[model samples]
Target: MGYKLNIHDPQDPTSLPPSTRSRLASGRRASESIRVGIPLDYNIATLQPSVRNAWIRTLKALHANGHTLHPVRLPATQRALSAYYVLAPAEASSNLAKYDGVRFGSRAEGIDGTPESVLFAKTRGQGFGPEVQRRILLGAFSLSAQAIDNYFIQAQKVRRLVQQDFDKVFAKQNPLLDDIAETEGTGDKVDVLLCPTAPSTAPLLSKVEAQDPIQAYMNDVFTVPASLAGLPAISVPVPSATEDQNIENEEYTPFAGVGIQIIGQYGDDKLVLDYAKELQAVARDS
Candidate 1:
C-alpha cells in the first residue's frame, strides 16, 4: 500500500512532546516527508474489494501529487511470524499464571480428592480458544525448569532480533534507542513508516476459520514487529473506486480499502497521526 506524508497540526489534543509548541513558536517548517513501504509479497489480485480500491486510490494519489515512496521487502517476515507465535504465547503463559483461582479468579466449588483440581482445568478449558490453548501449553512447557533457558530464553532473543531488523530498515530511528549514534546518517529516518496493515484484508470469518491455523497466524505478521518494539502505529482504510468486483476472488476482489498502516517511533505519536491525516487528505484528493 502507498502512504502519503503530510504536515501535522500541533493544536490536536492527542499530540505528544509538548515541544511542538516550541517548534511552532520557533517558526520551524511543519512539512513532514511521506514514503510508502509496500511489502514485496503484496499481490493486488488477492486483496478484498474494498481494500484493493483503497490501495489503488493511495497509489494514484501519491503519483498525482509527485510524492516518492520507498519500497521495503523483509524476507524474514515469515520467520518473524513463527518466532512471534512461539514467543508471545510463552510470554502469555508466564504473565497469565497469576490468574489461578487461589490468586485472582473465580474458583470452582467442587474440589475434594483429585491430585490436580478439575475446577482449574475446567475454567481454563472453557475460557480459552484452541489457539490460546496451544500457546498456553507451549508456554507451560517452555517455562518448566528444564526448558526455561533453551526455549523461553531463546525466544526472547529472537523477539529482540525482530525489533532490531525493523530498526535497521525504516528511515526513522526508534525514539527508544539508548544510543543515538548507532542511527546516524540513516537518510531522513522518515517521520513515519508505512506498510500493509495485514497480510491481506480481513478475510470472511468462515474462510478464516477453514484455513490452516498457521495462515491465520500470518495475518498478524506485518503488524507484529511494530507491536514488539512498542512503536505507535495506525491502520487507515484506502477506498477503491468501483463496486462491481466478485465477492469470492481472493485477489482483486473489492471489499474494503486495504488498511495501510503508519508506524512511528516511541514518543512520536503525534507526528505519526499528523502525517496520517495528511495522507488521508492526499488520498481523498487523488
Candidate 2:
C-alpha cells in the first residue's frame, strides 16, 4: 500500500507536480476514524477456510483500532463474475479487431487471399493465445445480432446493477451520478468496503492448468465486482506470521499470504491508500 520512490534523488517528492505532490502528502497522513462495511453474506461459500479466518482477523484488528465496522450484504456482486466475462470479451473483440495482420500486432507470413481471408485467420491464430482467442470468439458471438439482446444487453444491465450496489454502500457520493436518488440503499453508508482479494491464495501452476476454465474464472469473483463499479481498490497482504499461524498442523497455510482488499468510492484513491497503510500495520500486529 505504501510506495517509496526508488529514484536516486531523495528530494523527488518536492519535484513532483503540484497535484501529484498534494495527493502524495494526503496519502501519507493517517486516516480519521471512518465506518467500514464488511459483507457478512457475500462470497461466503467461495472463500477458503484460511482466507475467511484471515479476513475476520483483519476486521477485528480494524475494529480494535477504533474504526466502526458495519455488516452489509451486496447480492448484486455475485452476478458480476458472469457479467464481466461477457462484457469484457465483447469489448476486447471490438478493440482488438484491428490487430488482424492488417493493422497493429504481428502479421502471418505467406498467407494467400486478402487480409480478411486466410491472412487474418492465420495471423490471429498464431498471434493470440488460446485464452485470448477463446474470449475473442465468445465476444464476437455475444455481440452478434442474434445474441446481443440475450447476452450483451443483459451483461450491460448487470454491470449497472453492480455499480449501484457499490454506490449504495459508499458514504461518499459518486460524482458521476446525476442526482442524489442514485445513492439510496437499505443500511447506513460506509466510507469503505473490506473483503478478501481472492477466494484463496495463489494456486500452483499445475493445479491451475488441471482445473476447468470456469473454475479458473472463479478466482476473479471477488475482484471483478470492484472493477465493474470503477472503484478504487487495493489488495493488502496479511502478514505471513498471522496468515500462517497453523503452520505446525497439516492445514492449508498460505505461503504467499492472503490478500485483504479495501475498496473505496470513486475518486477516493487517496483515502484508499491511507486506509491501506493503517490496515497493513494492523495486519503485521495481528
Candidate 3:
C-alpha cells in the first residue's frame, strides 16, 4: 500500500561500480540510497570475500539506481535454521514412511510373504537416496518418545517464534487485536527485504558434492527464516562484477552467478515478482 516514486537528476549520484555498496555505508550519498534490510544473525562471514563483494556490487548498483538502503534486521534466522533441519526431515520421514513396498512402491520379487520385514527393508534401502535415508533415520529418532519433546516439540515452538519475528517486521496488525485497541506493528516497516540467495555464489558442482551432508545444509541458513514463515521469496540472479575474475581458491573457478533474494510479507506474491522484474530490467539496461 505504500508505494511512491521520486525524480532526481541522473548526474547527481556518483558513478561508482556495484562493488562500492559496502562502502556506501560511509558515503555521503548513503542517505539517499534505498533502505534495504538484511536479516540479523545470518552467517555472513561464512561466505567467501569475493561472494560478499559480489553482493556489495549488486547493492551498490541498486543504490546507484536510486534506491535507499535501510538497516532492517530479522531476528529469527538461527532459530528457524535449527527448526527447519529438524522439522523438514521429520516430515520427510513421516511422508516417506508410506512408501514401504507392500502398501506402495515396487516389491522385491525374490522374497514375497515369508520375509516381509526383509522385503520392506530391501525395498526402502534400495529405493531411497542416501540423504533421504539419513533424514529418515534422524526424523525417526527425533519423533521417538524420548526425543520427541526435546527435538520435535521444541522445534515447533521455535517455528512460532520464526513466524512472530516475520510478522513483527512486516508490521502485521492482528485482526483480532484490532477490536480491542490499536495493535499497530513495528513503526519502521520496509516494503521488502533484500538478502543473499545463498551464503555464497554458486559453488562448483564437484566441490559441492564433496561437502559433508550436514555442511551442505548450511547453504540454506540465510533462507530458512523466511521459508519457515511461508513468505514469498524470489531469488533473482544478477550478473556478477567479477564475472571472469577467477579467485585462487583451493578448487574450481569463482562463481559468476550472483543471486539476490527479495522477500515480501506473507501473501504479497505480486509485490515480490513486480520488484524482482524491475530489478532485472534495471540490471539489463545498465
Candidate 4:
C-alpha cells in the first residue's frame, strides 16, 4: 500500500523518461465497478479449510463493495498445471545450458582441457542444486529427439488452450489479436477473475521437507494456469478467520493469512493492479 509507480514501455523509448519512482505516490482505484468472476469450482476440493474460509471472506468483502461477482469455470486449469511442469522444465533446461564451465556460472576445478561434454557435465553437476538439476534433466528429456513431439509439443498446445480459456472470460479482448476489439468493458464477460493464490497458507517447515516432489509441485496448482497464459495476476494476502489466539503454548502455530489472486487479460496490467489496490483496501478496512 505504501508503494508508488508508473508504467513504462521498454520498446517505446518515449515511455521511459517518466521513471516509476517519480510518479504520484497514491494508489488508483478502478474508475468503474466492473463485473468480477470468481472461479468457485477451480481446485476447491483440495483447498485447505483455512484458505477456503479466507476466500469466502474476501468474496463477501467484494460483494459488499458494490462489485458484481459470478461463478465461472476454466476447464483447462488442471491440464494447464500438467502442461506447465512439462513446458517450464523444458525451457529451464535449454536456457540454463549456457552455464557450463567454459562460459557461465561457477566452473569446477580439475577439468581443464577435458572434452566439452565432460567439462559441461562436471560444471553443472557441481553448480546446480537438486531441484534445478531435476528440472534441467526433465527439460532435456522432454526436448530429446524421440520425446520432443510427444511431450514438449503437447505442452505447447495445452499452453495455447490456457491462453484461449482466459481470453474467453475477460470482457477486454487480448491486445495481441490482429483485429483488436474496439469495444471494451461493454459485455457480459468479466473484467477480472478472482481466485486463491495457493491451495493453502504457509506450510510448516517439517511438512515442507516431508513433501515429495510431485506433492510439492501441487502447491502451484492454482497459479500455473494464469502463468502459462501470460496474463497479469496479483496475489493479495487476506487474513484468515481461523487464527488460534489461545495457541500461545503450542510448539507450532499456523500462519493467519492466505493470498487471493486477481487475474486480468493480456495488456490489462493496469486493470489488475487497480483491482488489487481495491482488494488491499478491502482487506485493511476489514
Candidate 5:
C-alpha cells in the first residue's frame, strides 16, 4: 500500500474508526477551529447540578481563551430519548430470540424438565440476568401480535424523526441516505456539538446496586439522542474545579472531572475525534 498523509497517529493508529481513516484520505486533518460561537444545547443544561457546573466552568475557560459561546435549545431531545428506550429494547428482544437452546442457547441441564418446551423455558430463565430478562419481556410485549402496530411500528417512526433532528443541526450529509434532495429543510447547522456525556458523574457502586435499574438508564440521557441518530460521539474529560471552586454536591466528588462529549454527523467520526482532542488540549493547557 503506497499512500501519503498529512497527519497520522501512532499511539492507536490503525484502530481508528473507518470513517476517520476515509476522512484523512482527503489529505488534510481539517480546517482550523473557527471563531463561531459554540452552541450549548438546552437539554444538557438540565443534567445534574454538578455536571452543569463543570460545563459552565469549561465554557468560561473557553471564553477566557477567546472563544464565543452561544446557548441554544433542542426540542426533540425528550422525544428522542423516549424513543431509544422503546427501539433499543425492541431490537434487543428480536436479536436475543436466537438464544433458544435448540440452536443457540445455554442448556440449563440443572433444571429437571421432560418436554423440549420446558427446557426452552428453563434455559432462558436461567441464562438471562434480571435486567436483560426485563428488557426481553418488554421487547416481546412490544413486538407481540396485538401490540406490534401500536408499539414497535410507532417506535420505528419515532426513530426516523430522531435521525432528522440531527441532520438539521449538523447540515452535513447523512451517508445512509441515497438521495440528498429531500434533506430536512434549511436551519442553522453546527460544525460539532458539545455537551455533557451523562446526567451526572459516576455513582458509588453500592448506591448503583441499590437503586431501581431503570433509574440508572437516565444517566445515559445526554448521550442517547446522538446514538439514536447514528452519529459518532466521543467524551473527553476536562479538569475538575478545585475544592473551593467546586459546587457542593453529595453525588459528585473532587476527583470527578467533567465528561464533555463531541458529536459529528454520520461518517464524520474522524472530525468528532479531532474536536475532542482540540477541546482536551485547551483544557490541559489552561
Candidate 6:
C-alpha cells in the first residue's frame, strides 16, 4: 500500500489557534499550496482564461485514471519559509558582497570627486532594492565575527533539518544521498505523494503583491522541499466540476483550478513525467 500522511490539524477544529489562524487568514498557507506545480509552460504575458481552462481539463483527465493521490504534509513545511529567507539572503549577502569596487567589480567613476564616502553610498543605494538592502545588512551583521556561530551557523543547521523533513516523506530517496535506499527508500517504494499545489487557486496579481513578504515567501513552501532535495516534480491542474454538475464550488472552478504535484527520484525524471502524462489523461477522461 502507498504510504499516507496528513499535515493538517489533527482535531479538525472549526477554527485554528490564533497563531495558526492568522497565518491561514493572511493567505500565507494558501500561497504555499499553489506554487508547487506552476507549469513551466505558463507565461504570464500570454496567459488567457481559455488557456487556464485547457490546463484544468488536462488535470481532470489525469484524476480519472487509476492513479492514487496521497496527501503528504510535513508540519515543518511552514517553518521552512522563515528558514529559507534567513538562509538564502544570508548566503546571497556574502556571495554578493564581492561586487564591491577595488576588490571586485568596476569602481565608481567619481572615486576622487568631492567626497569619496558619498559616492560609494550613492552607488550601493541606487543598485539595491529595499528587500535586498535589508538582507545584505542583516547578512553582513550575521557574518560578523561575533555573530557567525549564533546566527549564520544555526541557520545552516536549520536548512539541513528542513531538507531531512522532505527526505522523510517523498516516495523516493534523494539521489544525492550517499546511500539512496538507506537514506529513505527506493523509487518503487511508493507510487507518488500528493498534496495541494497551493492552499488555494491563483490569487489576483495585485493581491499577491499587497501581501506580506513572508506571506509571499510562503508561496514556495510546498515546492521548495522538492527543489532542495533535487527531486523531479510536476504540477498538473485539477479543475472543479460546474454547478449543474454535482461538485461543490470549492471543488471545481471555471475561472481557476487546483494543481497537484508529482515528485520522483533523482534520475527518475522520465518516470515522473510519464506519471504526469497519465494523470493529465485521467483528468481529461473524468
TM-score for all predictions?
A: 0.73, 0.83, 0.78, 0.84, 0.80, 0.60
Off by over 4 Å in 1: 1-31, 35-57, 73-76, 116-119, 180-188, 209-211, 241-255
Predicted candidate 3 versus true structure: per-residue lDDT over 77-104, tens digit per residue: 6677789999998999999998988899
Badly placed stretches (over 4 Å) of model 5 are: 1-31, 35-41, 44-46, 63-70, 111-118, 178-187, 243-246
Best by lDDT: 2
lDDT of 6 by residue, 1-286 (tens): 8754323465777333444433321112211112122223222342333334544554344344433333344455555556666666787788877666546655655642245363355556656778889888888888889988987787667767756766665544554566443643342334444444554566666676677876666566657656655566899876544532333333233566667677664555656676666666666565
User: What ranges in model 2 sit over 4 Å off?
Assistant: 1-29, 112-118, 181-187, 240-254
TM-score of 3: 0.78
Cα lDDT for residue 258, model 3?
64
Question: Model 4, range 1-286, lDDT digits (tens) per residue?
Answer: 6754456666776453454324323422587787889875574687877677678788889989999887777887879879999999999999999998678788778754355456467778888999999999999999999999999999999999888888877776675655554555555588899899988777778877877999889889989999999888999988766453342422235555788999988767778898899999998877
lDDT of 5 at 286: 55
Per-residue lDDT tens digits of candidate 1, residues 1-286? Answer: 9764434456755554445333322211236335555555444344445554566567667656655666555554546666676678878898777666767766655652256664477666656778878888888888889988987777677778767766666665555455466655755334456666774666676786698977777678778877766677998766555552544555444454567888765655676777677778876665
- Model 4 clash count equals 0
* Structural RMSD, model 6: 15.4
Candidate 5 lDDT by residue in tens digits, 1-286:
9776534446665454554545432312544543222434544554767667667776776667565555445556767667777778888899999997779966878653666565578788888999889889988888889998988788778778777767666656666665557555534555567777887777777778898867887777788888888778899997665642356566665566778887777767677777677788777875
Better of 2 and 5 by lDDT: 2
Backbone collisions counted per model? 21, 0, 12, 0, 0, 17
Query: For model 2, where is the 10-residue window of minimal lDDT?
Result: 19-28
Alpha carbon RMSD to native, model 2: 6.3
| TM-score leaderboard ranking | 4, 2, 5, 3, 1, 6
**lDDT at residue 33 of model 3 (Cα atoms):** 35
Instruction: Candidate 3: list runs displaced more than 4 Å.
Output: 1-35, 112-119, 171-187, 243-248, 251-255
Residue 257, model 2: lDDT of 81
Clashing pairs in 4: none
| TM-score, structure 5 vs. true | 0.80
